[model samples]
Target: MCVHGSNNNPDIGQLLEGLPTNWGKWGPDDEVGALNYLQAEQVLRGIAAVRQGRTFTLQIPIGHEKGEPLFPGRRPSMRMNVLDKGHYLAGKAHFDGNVEFSDDVIFMHVQGSTQYDALGHVWYDDKLWNGYDAMSTIGSMARASIVPIAERGVAGRAVLVDMARHRGKAVLDKGETFTHHDLLAAARAQGTAIEPRDILIIRTGWIGSFYEREAAEFYSDFVEPGLTFSRELVEWFHAMEIPNLVTDTMGNEVTVDPRSGVMIPLHAALMRNLGVAFAEVAQLDALAEDCARDGQWQFLYTAAPLKIVGGTGAPVNPLVIK
Candidate 1:
């Protein structure tokens, strides 16, 4: 079924009633959510895990000609040249210093590329993370915007749970789902364990497939195959103290819940309630392949999102150093 056409979905508020929450766990004014778990100690731990000194940047190019993978309504970034050789040749521009440079402006969402979502990105029942009022997001994300996340930054040990590789497929089928148990199994198979507060990066090979297929074929029947929400899965994340969730998919989880027909309950169940930070649309193909080859699944993960004030989210290119 299509993501938007969920047949008789349950009330998200009622559907998520009584799920565990981290509201006020830090303080009444807290904003960065579980990323607060990444302190100096976590940074040191990340450094310790870096043995090979290999660095991989995990972001897709912003302005791909074939078009970037995006959610249904969002459009790809468009870059327009304001100053370039053409302008200079047209005699519309001249430099006294004989220096010419190209300048362009990009028009796109703050979440247009690999991005880190603010705690207030989504909510229900008139509240965001840390019990902030839902109305605080009016006009801009007046509260719990991505600024705090960008300010603090994220650096820590991360485990790559290559779900697509674990399942012996180049890409998981559309709408395929996995849970905490599956994550554990995949980690075991990869010869690693997901430690507490670790940045959890999962690969479905979904984003990698975009380069190999047409945008129409990719967006067709676009129920992204990914983690399915469950009480046990939520509890596992809380128990593990996971600081961030990174994935190659757009929504980061199965686009629509099959049983409840709810679209991305994890956005509410984990992010809104439990304050788990989300990094979506990451490019993880090369990293996953190397991890599989070397069996080095744990690495140093670092990301610094642009400090866009009042932004609901901001573009980021996370680094994985092994």
Candidate 2:
């Protein structure tokens, strides 16, 4: 639980067990990490690939009853809406032209559903991405909030690494781990090449389990089929310079690590150390099916997190166009 300042020399290699990081690579004041690689040319390349005007929404329903929250202390969203008739009559005001109007308010955890993790979401050795102070920089008046991500607007060429399809399964078994080797194998099988600044979307088929089992059974064990935070994967991500990674599973990586015995190491390593963002709980089944039908795996993907200042994360509705 050691906290280091921006200029302090923290033993990150020892902490991550020889895994190097990109801290200070962008700059001392840099909040946007690997995302800086997303250039105008990349966006143009993504748009140029759109032969068909088909679009897919990669976000789950905000209040999906079947898909419950997997993380503890994160509850389902609650929405309360008042009908136009009840509201208009209650307000004692006559509508001018449109007599009916409805209003609703929602309250829920940002990470409870399909969401984007801000750069300030994770920290290692008491420091955040680019050596930003974790403690003092994530509150009411802090740096590296969701504003930068919102301002940048994640739109680029996205490649889907369909793990379930590669394994020939509807859904991966619980506790199964997809490693770096598997990622490359999946890409090779799909005839796709990993590119720099590409938005990587992984479909584990874990969300199918949520629909198959009861809510209690689905969320009880906290076990899932997801990527493994292996040193090989970290090295590959660094080498490829991927901007963001999204997965259908709640946690991007398997919760129980058999190798290092560390939990959520990918979160700390990617977000905290390398400043790579993550979009969790993505709904990729529809997109995967469409890609399979068209034999086109690459698409133009865009996501914009809520512009909540000082917010750690925000629910997102990502759009993929082909």
Candidate 3:
């Protein structure tokens, strides 16, 4: 009989009973709810293993897409200036000049390029993550405006799912959207199975075209080449309870929905709804090649964003150590 309860739904019990006899069983008293005694024991064991410091880190660099200039119908260009003040020896004495440093310049604003977007960076309708209003949450501060991501330093076993190798191509089409099935297929192709709490690093091979100014052109209204995660994919990540999702692309998702002409929905679903921090604009071309040759997807990930207080996002230099 199927018993329905809001707090303790007995329907779960009936569902478990329908499983094959060889399947494990759990009692209400001996076991904690649906998790059987053996399953719970395994969970505790896994927790202990994680506490023992068995993990790797991958560093992903934020590309030069953000520093590019935006001119109508002009190819994007990067403009960075360095100011150095030194001493000149004059009359057997060193004379120091006035110190000055400036990188104050305007260029094309690549919203997702090498950026860790604050919770206020994007909002769903009117509500930001954790029910914080976008406008209210963002102000003069840059880094601290969002949650303390860098403070904790996301650490975990990173799995690089190389989609480019699976497709035998360098870049996925600008408007292509990646579904849950596509991700699974890519993983299977690489012979790497994604586990729970694993930092999923997706390499779409888009960073190669980043330096190709002509091919990687930015349109005022049109979409660009990148992978868009489907709704199912977001749910899968949540169910798996992964620590974070890192990708090598501008937005980590296709810019436009091929059918609906809308922008990335996965960003909202993953970052806002699931509280999943996304590491975007990752430079993964070289890392992908190494992983493909070595047949290993693990890497030590390290990324430290500028400590810009009360800011929306900060420039980051993420690196990967094998």
* Highest TM-score against the true fold, candidate: 1
Query: Which pairs of residues clash in candidate 1, taking residues 3 or more apart in a chain or in different chains?
Result: none
Better of 2 and 3 by TM-score: 2
By lDDT, who's the top model here? 1
Summarize candidate 1's per-residue lDDT along 95-168 as a digit string, tens digits.
89899999999999888899999999988889888888988898988899999999999999999999998999
RMSD to the true structure for each prediction, in A, is: 1.6, 4.4, 12.2
> On residues 195-251, what C-alpha lDDT tens digit does candidate 2 reach at each position?
777889999888756777777767676667888776778888888888999999988
Better of 1 and 2 by lDDT: 1
Rank ordering of all candidates by lDDT, starting from the highest: 1, 2, 3
Alpha-carbon lDDT, every model: 0.91, 0.80, 0.53
Please say which candidate is ahead in TM-score: 1 or 3: 1
TM-score of 2: 0.90
Which residue runs does candidate 1 get wrong by more than 4 Å? 1-7
Candidate numbers sorted by TM-score from highest down: 1, 2, 3
Candidate 1, number of clashes: 0
